[model samples]
Target chain A: MTFKLFSEHLLIVVAAEVLALAVGLPLGVLCYFSPKARKPILWVVDVLQTIPALALLGIIMVLAGAGKQTVIIGIALYSLLPIVQNTNLGLLQVDPGVKEAACGMGMGRMYRLIHVEFPLAFPVVFTGVRIAAVNAVGSAVFAAFVGGGGIGTAIYKAIRIQNMNMLMQGTATLMAIAIALDLSMGWVEARIKRGHSSMKKAPARRN
Target chain B: MIKFEHVSKKFGKKQVLDDMNFEIPDGQFVVLIGLSGCGKTTTLKMINRLIEPDEGRIYIDGKDIEKVDKVELRRQIGYVIQQIGLFPNMTVAENICVVPKLLKYDKESRDRIVHEMLDMVNMPYDEYAHKYPSEMSGGQQQRIGVLRAFAASPPIVLMDEPFGALDPMTRETLQDEIKKLQKKLNKTIVFVTHDMGEALKLADTIIFMEDGKIVQMAPPETMLENPANDNIRRFLGKHMNDDAVTLTVEDFMRTNIITVDKHRGVRECTERMARTGVDTLLVVDESDKYIGTVSIKDIRLRGKNEKLIEALITDNAKTVRRDGDAHECFDHLLNSGDNYVVVLNNDDTIAGIVTKNSMAKALSDTLWGDER
Candidate 1:
């Protein structure tokens, strides 16, 4: 029974993360480029984040007719704020001199963004994505209350029947996953930062 | 050739650049000189479209710059700034070849051009090409900035106080190197400097700016000799004092002084000296090597048959070089404990004479009014 619950929980968390990234990245880039669209969109996302996780589950379940889909939607919305804000902040903070130099050298808008601005802004944006992922992992457990499936269900079951052993295993596994993800994301962020710093250190060779 | 046609730019309500018009001819080193907030930098930026003028147009090679593709246009015209603005991410060689690479120059061609530019700027390719901007001194970085601007051998280059951040000695050395390079390359260069001396030394023509308007534009000598207005006169402020003292040697040197060989007759030397109404004459060989000097009194006392040039002449007379300063001549006369001094040229030829009276007159002329 514990094995079944663990497998189900793992699958649900993975699926939720993938969904959030797929939807969030493009939205973040859009918000970063479009100044007019950013404030209103971010305001809506901020308000969504204020909704209690459990109530969000309840509200989503009623609208989407319950189960895993409803919980995933709720968690994804909750994760949007950090990712959007950080992406926008990171791109905006890229050195204007670099951008101007690129432009002066006849680099088109697309090329400048891809080669100069995007690479430079990657680390900060990655931090945002990592935060969002961690938030998603923690929030996935709440989905189990609505029968959305995951370790949260095991914990809920343990609570219903007063099973401390089952509760410890589910809670422990969830903590392990979160810690491992956080550390790996941190490692990836560090690698990107090092790459950027080294590139800066390298003399700009012509041709 | 570049021409600014009645250009005016304003940032909000503050007019940073008033209606300005100027034409820079091809292959000329034109320097714009002014104080801070004089809009020289703004004028430079407008050429590359980094700052667009609110009114009027700029033409490059007789076509409106606004009509050209800005990115391509900028790639062809090089720019160097006071802060350098070298891409910290790029190596020295890479920084130098940025425009060429952008223009799609092949790897071999780009490498060759980068090396040539580095060499031209006095930073040899091997030692500096692989180094980053942060690893170099301010002067070296500034040199790299200049090399980068010339990397593609652009016909036109604009520099905004490129050496302004360097130490005085480095600035002077770099300024000389830049002048040499510009002479060799013959590029149309617009060099911006706040330092009047630098402008005077480098500019083929100077544009003096005030309140975003060009107050006067003329060659350095003309500007120094006859400033356009009172403001310009005040701005130039006693440039004659700053004129190198070496130039005053010509004015103070005595042209009527005579010289004789060591074997010359006293009577003949005295006759020549008396006819010239001078007491002293420098003794020299046929080749004009300065041997010594003879006085009229020496000739009168010593026998006429005796060699007055050698027997009674002062062999240890004080002397100055032809290029020596008028001030130095005055100092020598006052402190030498002698009435006169001989002046020699580089070849040891007798150039002229400096006496106590002449030194005093030169000093007084420099110090007092020219009422006489």
Candidate 2:
């Protein structure tokens, strides 16, 4: 029973993360190039972040009419803030010296951006994805309220029935999943940092 | 040959190159030198079309550069700049072969070129080729930058203060390496620098500029001897003052000397040598031009009065240009039994004679003047 709930919960969060990155990255890249779109796009995302999670999920539920579709849409929208902001920030943070070196070597604009600028920005962009992944664990629980059953539904039922054993098991499972996900994501972040030696906070290189 | 005809460039209100006309012969190493804002760099970049001239035309090998595609022209002209310009993400070999790759050389050839260039710079190909730019020191990185420029074997290479950022020792090593490359490859090079010492040491011809105008274009020796104006004199400053002037043979040469016609009788030549308190006389032709030297010993052994001094003349007599460094002649005189080095003008006419006594007297005077 717990396995089924954990699987459903993991699927929703992962799906939301993948969807958020796809939509946010291109939108972020577009904002990076076009000044006119930057202001409006960033404002909308910022406003989306300020909206209460349950309130936003309720609004999405009204439009999509509940279940996994509404829950997934709500969580993806919630995660867009970190993904879009970081994509923009990462690109903007690429060293000007590196860009100048690339252009001087006769690399065309598109080639330089893709091959030189984007690679340099990758570690920072991945940090945003990691942050969104961890945050999505908590946000995915909202799916239970909309009748999109996950680990959240089991915890909800345990609380209503005052069953101490079920409550402990449900809460312990979420805690365990969160701890495991955070540790694995942290390891991935460390790996990302190691790949780019030039970055300031990059850990001591292995022999 | 590269020629700039009435070239001018302006950046808003600032005129960088103004009606500049110059010619650089094939295989000559030319250095453009001046103060920071004097447009020496602009002049070099104009050749590769990095910075285009606002007016007038530039021709390389009698073909207008404007007619050539800018990208193609840049690829053909090797360019090394102050920043070293090596892409940090690229390995040394990759950076060196960037232009060669652009030119579409096969993988085998590009790899071979990379190894060859690093080898020429004395950086082992195996050790440095796969290493990224950040892995090397600033000097090593710049050495890769230079090797990259020459990888395609371009007919002309342009350097804009390529070693300006290195320490003195590394700069000297790279300068020597580039000089060797220039000689071995026989490529026409246009180098730009604000460093006068670098200009003097490397240039076959140094073009000194003031306010976007070429104040003087002459060889290092000529430039030191005759600066075009007071502005140039001030720019030359200490370099022209104590070291160059005192060390030059022209300042110490004895201007008034007699030349014996190579066809003159040995009897007359011996008489002249005796009268001048000298054992030898300079042998010249009937045109009153220099031929060689005839010693009294040679004249005596060939005692026939009808025998011409030309018969006794030894062709091994050394000659030095009047504008040449006196120390060079000084060192030569110290190592040889010869009393003098014949000093000649640009026209090759005898300017004067520089002997051990003449240079000593001139140097002693400067030392005493300094003491006073």
Candidate 3:
């Protein structure tokens, strides 16, 4: 029973994160290029994050009629802030010299963003993605209040019936999921960073 | 030819380029030099429309550059910068082919161009092609940066203090290589550098700027002989041999000396000597410290069985510190049987060679005044 609940929780987090990334990446690029659009777009995502997870899901459940889809939408909205903000920051932090070289070499805006700036900015962006994924794991617990079943349902029932054993199991499983997601994503980020620094010795000496 | 007609630009209240008018003829190596705010870089950027002028127009080959699409124009013109901004994510081959790929060249043609470009810098295609920028040295990265610029065979190339960040020795080597490449490729190169020595070495025509205006434009020899103003005279400073009573060895030494690595093969050394028309090649170790000198005669006599020139190096050549008195060095060269005296920096790297011909040329410049 605990194992099945854990998988369902994992499913919600993964699905929500995928949806968030798909919407957030292009929105971040849009924020990077257009100064006028960046203000409103960032403002909306930042406001979305300020809404409490349960209240946000309750509102989504009212609109979408209390299902897993409503919970997924709520978690994805919550995930947008980190993903969008990080993508914008990553592109901004790319080496200016590299950007200038890209433009000077006749690369159009989209070409440079895809080929040069985006690749260099990827490690920073991955860190953002990791943050969102871990946060979403914790946020998915709100799914129980909206009939989107997961470990959260067990925790809710344990709290209502005063069952210590069920509460401990649900809380422990949620914590484990968060930790696992953080560790695995952290590993991937470290691998990307290592690839850059392994050959990072000082330039060759002139013969 | 690139012609700027009444071009002017302003950033807010400060004028960056003030009605700039200049014509660069075909196949000339022109250098733009000035202080930090002199607008030399701004002027270079305007050529490819990276920064559009507030007024007036620029013409390339008599066609208005403003009418040409900026992207297409930039692709047809090569550019290199001081920071050596090669893409960290791309391999050396991919970095070189950036412009070619933009122009939509096929895979076979791009590979051939990459190999040819690497070959021009003596970097073996097999070795460096797959290597990332971080794996290479500063000098090697800059070489690849240069190769990337020229890969598309642009008719004109622009360099903005491209060797500014390198050590003096590496900078000298790159300067020589670039000058040779520019001549061979016959490209009209507009190079910008703050170092007058770099400008003098590489430019056929030198355009000095101040306060967003062209202070003077002339050949290096003419500019040195008759500077347009006191600012230029001050800029020339130590290079003006006329003002000195006790000149140093640096003023007399010709920096265009051919050098060979100690580990290079005997055949390669002979080829370098023959191509550059030098009898002796200064030998430096891997760290680039001057070890000794290797002569063509020594290689012919004792190098028959030798594989590397490291074995053929000998310390018989006379040496002098770069800061040594020019007259004393001249006397030493006349008295010694050696054809030229190797001038060494404080750390013992080869600064230059003070051959009799170079001294004669220096003396002629002193005597002839305004004449070449």
Candidate 4:
């Protein structure tokens, strides 16, 4: 039962994060490139993030009916801010000289974005994704309140039966998973940073 | 060949470049020198269409630059900036091969050309081909910036203070290397610098700019000798001493001399020295060639009965070439950790001595003369 609960919990959070990234990254990149569209899009996202998390979940639960779909939608909305903000920040922060040099070398816009801008912006964007992922995993446990199914169900059961051990076990496992995910992401971030510094150093060595 | 005809550029209400007209002959090294905000950099960018002119046109080779596709035009010409602007994410080899890769050169050819360019820039292929920009010093980064510009072997190169960020020693060395490379490559070069000395050293012709206008365009020698107006004269003030400062060892050489042979006694040497009243005497070999110098103190330190030849000591004295200028002389004095240097002739013979006092006097004379 515990394994089933853990797997289900992991799957829902992963799905939510993946969905959020898919929607948010392109939006962020678009906002970065199109000066005209950025302000309006950012305003709308800002308003969306202002909604209380429980209020948003309760609103979605009423509108979509309680289940995995309702919880996923709620978590994905809550996860959008970090991913979008990060993607925009990352792309905008790319060195203008590097972009110009790339273009001056005859790289088209698409090629420059993929080869130059994206790699330079990767670490910053990854940071955003890390924040969003942790947030999504924590929020997924709350889905048990709407009958979405996960370790949250055990916590709910223990609460109704006045069983502290079951409650502690459920909460402890979620914390462990969150910590493990954070550590792994940190490892990946360091690897990305090392690769970036190495790339940054290449032209300097030639001189 | 590149020509700017009645070119003017304005940003909003402010005019940055005003009716500037100049022509650079094919295969010529033309340097633009002026103070900061002089539009020298703007002029370089205009040629590549990085900054558009408000009025008039720029011609490259024969056609109007505006008519040519900008990307294609830029790809055909090499552009270097002080910041280097090498793609930070690319390897040294990749940075060198950027344009070729853009032009769709095959992988094998690109790799070969990258290696060749690294060699051309004096960064050997084996040591630097795979290295990154961050591992190198400012000087190395600047050299790669130059190589990156020439990697595609463009017929023209535009440099905007390319070595400006380097230390003085590195800057001068790079300047010399680039001059040699320019002669060998014979590419049409448009170099922009704020340093008048750099322009004097490198330019075949100089364009003196002020507030985006070309005040004068002439050979460096002509510009130095005859500035057109007060503005032109003041612009070239720093470089006025360049000629006098660059004297070679040959210039200060004095051949006629009083000398003594190794067999001479201290009493006999003293008589010759008394007649000349010189502090030191040049000792000659049997062939009347230069051997060493003997001082009165050296003879006095030895007993009169001792053989003067055996008593005389030889010291390796510092020498400068006759062709060296005051700048070179000053550098030698500073580097030698000594008070004076003997200037030498082209034949490697003693010319004359340049004491610290002479160098100081020459510099002051030039400075005072320039003030008037």
Task: State what share of the real interface contacts each candidate retains.
Answer: 0.21, 0.08, 0.56, 0.45
Q: What TM-scores do the predictions have?
A: 0.73, 0.73, 0.79, 0.76
- lDDT tens digits, residue span A1-207, model 4: 289899988988888888888888888888898988888877777787889777887898899998888778878887788888888999998867677666655677777888789879999999999988887778887888887888888888999998999999998999988999999999999999888776665332222
Clashing pairs in 3: A203-B137, A204-B137
Q: lDDT tens string, model 2, B1-372?
A: 999999999999999989999999999999999988999988988898878899999999999999998767777888887877677656788888888887889999998999889889888877888988777788888888888889999999999898888888989999999999999999999999988889888999999998899999999878888888887677777678645444668988888788877777777877888889888777777666677888888777776654667667886778988878777898889889878899987766778898888877777877786354
Candidate 2, which segments miss by more than 4 Å at Cα? A31-41, A58-74, A146-149, A159-172, A175-179, A191-195, A198-207, B1-28, B38-73, B207-219, B228-231, B242-362, B369-372
Which residues of candidate 1, in runs, are more than 4 Å off?
A1-35, A54-76, A143-149, A187-207, B230-249, B252-372
Scored by TM-score, the top model is: 3
- Candidate 1 structure quality by residue, lDDT tens digits, A1-207: 367666776666667667766776667777777989888878987999989998888988889977888877887788778877777787887766556666655566676677667767888889988898877777888877887877888888889999999888888888888899899999999998886675554322221
For candidate 3, the chain B TM-score comes to 0.69
User: How big is the positional error of residue B266 in model 1, measured in Å on the Cα after superposition?
Assistant: 23
Instruction: Give every candidate's TM-score on chain A.
Output: 0.88, 0.89, 0.93, 0.91
Computed on alpha carbons, the lDDT of every model, listed in order, comes to 0.80, 0.83, 0.90, 0.80
Candidate 3 lDDT over residue span B33-137, tens digit each = 999989999999999888999999999999999999889999999999887788988999999999999999999999999989988889998999999999888
Ranking by DockQ: 3, 4, 1, 2
lDDT of 4 at A183: 91
For residue B231, what is the lDDT in candidate 1?
A: 73
Q: Residue by residue across A1-45, what tens digits does model 3's lDDT show? A: 377777888899999999999999999999999989999999999
Candidate 1 chain B, run of 10 with poorest lDDT: B240-249
3 or 4: which has the higher TM-score? 3
Worst 10 residues of 4 chain B by lDDT: B244-253
Provide the TM-score, chain A, model 1: 0.88
